[model samples]
Target: MKKILEIIRYEYVTQVRRKGFWIGIFSIPIMIILSSGISVLAMFIGTDRTPVGYVDHSGVLASPVLPEPDGLFGESMEFIAYTDPAVARQALLDGAIQGYFVIAENYQQSGMVEYFTPDLSYDMVIGDFEDLMRHNLLQAYPETVRTRFEQGSNITVRALESTQQLNLDQWWNLVLPLVIAFLLFILIQVGGSYILQAMVTEKENRMMEILITAVTPTELMVGKTIGNLGVALTMLLVWGLCGGAVLLFLPAYALTQVSINWGVQVIAIVLFLETLIMMACLMLMAGVMATDAREAGQLTWFFGLVMSLPFIVITSVIFDPDGPMSTIMSLFPFTAFFVMPVRMTFTQVPGWQVALSIVLLAGMIALAVWLATRAMKQGMLSFSRKIKYSDLLKQRRAA
Candidate 1:
């Protein structure tokens, strides 16, 4: 036990003292910041095209300039009037007009406006322009608003609200999957590499022989896995702090569209705890499988793909939170790390499922630690050959 503590202390101190550790830990937040800055700059500096061409047969609609729609279409547009449809179409074709609009005879009665363009984008441009024209018509005819159009008082309005109203952010299905992918990728790259390298280095130096004299390999493996997990946790905490700092210090102009939720504090805590368990299991596996730095380096790539398996599984889970596949993934020790948080965000998972996942993951970690320690005990003295997956399986069977 004392020797295990020493191994833990030694691994922690050695990693913490390395320049690479600090560099790797700090670079992720800096990259996120720089990418965010570029996105903001693109949003503000992108060129806006001036809209050209307008309605000529609009005696029914008495407006000189079409009112802009709300949101992205608000006030950043231009329109030109034309008396002849053919002339306007020609002008549009000639680039004299970027787009042309035509109102049929009795346009108000027909409720028809023809907008012509060079290609398929004509439909979108016309739809936006029609919205602009309607907005202007609304200003002139405030009586045309929905309250005036509906016959009943409270019942119709309430029915409309219930049937038609939607939470726009409900459409945000992609962010959860993206977050899952990123988290799993980090788990593979950071957590798995730490495990691989730790095993590899110890074997290469033959330090395991001396260490084994004082402590069993199980104790050494447990201590190393826990210590490296501490490193992964430290990196996560630092990145979380950096993210929080950006959120807090971001300028008002940078957050025009949405307010940052401080409740993410709770979310971050949950994520940190879950990720710690996952990394611990991965590190134990790395210790068992890696014999030297070269083999560890090669295994890192394969480990990365395996870790990403959960991320691929998450897409299906997000679409149907209660689907059979999702249920299977939620119970899976390997996949639960990616699927659980997303289920929390999109759907309310039963407390029992969460509990089951935690219990299963804990058991998996314990089993991995046992296996890793056994492998280390058998393989620690030999530095001549790489540790094969088959060898580990054979040793387990022999034991």
Candidate 2:
């Protein structure tokens, strides 16, 4: 136990001291800060809001009443009435306006209006002008009709015979599950890579032979796994702290809008931790079989793709959380990490199913650790060559 602790301390200290590790740790927060700063700067340094011209050939809007300029929203529209189309074209050429609108002579009857702009891709500008025209047209209607149009219609949605009542439209609830799943995926992949790299580096340096003289294969494997796990957890802790800070500083209205279930969150965290452990063990086995970092990376990426297959069908899991497909995915050890959390988030899963998934995942983790330990023992002396899966099993039987 003391030797294991020593190994953990050595691994942690050595990794933490590396410039790459520290750079990775702080990169995310730095990016967030820089993004926020750019946004704030852009708010102060506003974009140019060129005036738009209009030509009323229909004679309907001979003397139109435009809204007063409100600096809070943006620059007010400057309308220039032109009777001749040739004069309007010359004004546009002179750069007197950003765009021009031409109302047809039969505009009131045909409801046809033409707009000319150098850039047609300015959707926001076009949309704003359309909205302004619509509002003005509505104002010319009867008072009752104008009031009804302005007030708009109300819609109230109610769910009947529902097992779970969650607002899927809410930003946090919609995003949180995916965020958690993605984070778990990153943690497993990155932590596993660390284990693989460490093992390969030690082997290349002939440090494994020296370590073998001091500790058993099981201890070394367990120590390295636990050490890397600690590193991953530390990263999670730092990110959690940053997230907590954001939550603390967030507006009260934003907090009220997002409804979080603590019970579900706790369960998800446990499942994520378990998934990481299993991935770490599997990566250890891959590292044992790999002769170099290049081979280790290929093997790790292959496992990553297999593990990420659940994400491909995430849309199905979200829409039909309790369907047969979701059930099978939740029960399967490879996919359960992503599927189960999504199931728990959007719907109410049965207790038995959750238990079964947990048991299956736990069993897989144990089996993975056992296989990894055996592979490490056998492959320690067999360096610069790949370890066959069949040989490992056969050797276990022979032992």
Candidate 3:
């Protein structure tokens, strides 16, 4: 345990001190900031903020209620009332307004309105006028009814068998698990890649043989796996902090106010940890079996595909959360890291399945570690040869 802690400290310190590590961690937040700046610039550039003109023929808008001020964007379009269509058309021609909406005299019956614009360029402000019309149309209703109509409906989707409920207005809840799954995949890949690279580099340098003389192969493997994973976690932590800093200045404060499913989050975290261990062990084992870095890359590509299988069939998991495919994926060791967590967001996953997944992952992790140890012991002295998977399986059966 002391040796493992030392290895962890060495790995974390070595990685965090590297210039490449700081470069990669800072790139994400910088990209996010640049993209946000571009979006806001695009919102302001070539955008017509001209006041919109409307000729309301129907008397419903005669005493129109003042539409709510929409400061979400820079500024809301002013809905200028024109008593005459001829005057509104003249205004459009004279550049008094970008466009004018001609509400039909029988708008209450047909609910049809025609928009007239000279250049066919002012298409963005149409939605704002629709909101104004809706706001005025609801004036005849009671105050509560008007408020309800203005706010729209908050549809809550509840799972009958579980405590999971999602409000449509709060779409972040449904998407949060998927985001977590993606991040987990990224961290696992990063950790596994680092483990693979470290193992390959050390083997190329004949460092494995020199280290094994002082410690057992199993200890060396365990220490290396934990140490490299610490490096990956450190990278993730820095990236999260950078992203959190950027989120502070965003206008969408509601982005942070989403419902928190602590139970599912806890399960997702456990899944991530187990999967990370299993993947890191497998990567270390592959590094031991391969004769060189190229072979290790080829072998670990399969593991990456296995980790991404849940994402490949994610549509099915989302649409049919209780379906057989989701059930199978959630129970399977390779795909459960993502499938189970995302599935839980949509529907109630059976407790038995979650328990079984946990057990399977634990068993797989142990198997991976044992296999890695065996590969390390066999390949420790084989500087020119590679260990075959068949031999490992044969030895396993014999044992």
Candidate 4:
């Protein structure tokens, strides 16, 4: 146990110290931040915040009230009523306003308003102007009637026989599951690659012989797998910190306060850790079997493709969460990690399905560990040749 702990500490320190690891950790988040920043800057540059002049021939804007802002950031807009279309056009030409709306005399009956904008900057403010007109049109109505007309109707779907409910306001509920699954996929792939690296690098360089003198095959495998997983966890931690900071202090937009499903998150986390271990073992076996890292990568890529088949049918999972296809994928070992959480998020999945999936995954992991242990020493000791699956089983039986 002490030796395994030593191996874990050594492996964690070595991998985290690598420049590539740090680069991979920081590069993606930085790119996302920069991209989002550039997009927001471009939006601001494209906007024309100058006063917007209007020719109110219908007299609807005779008393124009300033509309409330509706965007990621506070808005600065003005709508000035004009007695003449010529004056409004001149205001646009003089750069006093980026756009002008000519309300026809029959606007109250025909609901027709002519828009003349020099640029696309008025695309966002058009809705606000319509709201202002609505507000003035409803001037004689009660406050409740005016508010309802302006706000529109929101439809919430609730099952007649059950407590199931869905609405546009709960969009984050649908997204949370996919995010959790993708995070699992990323951690498993990244951590598995490092596990392959740890084993393959040591074997090809003949360092495992030195390792073997002090540690057993099982110890080496478990320690290295866990250590690299720790490296991946460190990456997740850093990224989480960066994300938390952005959510708290982002200059462009404010994220709404959300109620997260911590229960589902905890389940996804356990599955992620177990799935990582299983994948790490398999990757270690492939690494020891291959002659070089490139060949190992090819083999792992094929394995990755097989595991990634679930993402192809993700649309089915999302739209029909309680359907048979989603349930089948939830139980399949290769697809369960990505599909199950998403299914759970979309609906109330039966407890039996979750338990069965976990049990089946445990069985798969045990089998993988057994095969990997049989191959580890034999493959590591003979770097000149590949360890055929047949040869491994036969050799293990013979021993």
The numbered model that scores best in TM-score is 3
Q: Write the per-residue lDDT of candidate 1 for residues 63-145, one digit (tens) a residue.
A: 65454344342445567777777777788888776777777667667877776767655243555566566665556555547
lDDT pick, better of 2 and 3: 3
* Model 1: ten consecutive residues of lowest lDDT: 156-165
Using all chains and alpha carbons, the TM-scores for the candidates as numbered come to: 0.75, 0.80, 0.86, 0.83
* Higher-ranked by lDDT: 1 or 3: 3
RMSD of each: 5.8, 4.3, 3.3, 3.8
Clashes of 4: 0
Q: How would you encode candidate 2's per-residue C-alpha lDDT over 1-399 as one tens digit per residue?
A: 888888888777777788887787678667767897888667546534677777887766676755434344556656677777778888888998777889888987997888887776653455546555655777678877865675555433233544455764465776787877777777777777778877887877778889989987777888888998888887788878887898999999988887776666776777778888998898888788777888777666767887888888999998898899999998888788788888887777888988888889899999999889888877777677878778789988899
Predicted candidate 4 versus true structure: per-residue lDDT over 36-132, tens digit per residue: 7999998888776787878888988787766566655778578878888998888889988878888889998999998898765438668767877
Can you rank all candidates by lDDT, best first? 3, 4, 2, 1
How many steric clashes between backbone atoms does each model show?
0, 0, 0, 0
Give the least accurate 10-residue stretch of model 2, judged by summed lDDT: 154-163
Q: For model 2, which pairs clash?
A: none
Give the per-residue lDDT digits (tens) of candidate 3, residues 258-350. 677888888887888998899999999888888789888877888888888887899999999999999999988888889998888888888
Superior candidate under lDDT, 3 versus 4:
3
Task: Decide which is better by lDDT, 1 or 4.
Answer: 4
**CA lDDT of 11 in candidate 1?**
79
- Compared to the true structure, candidate 4 yields what TM-score? 0.83
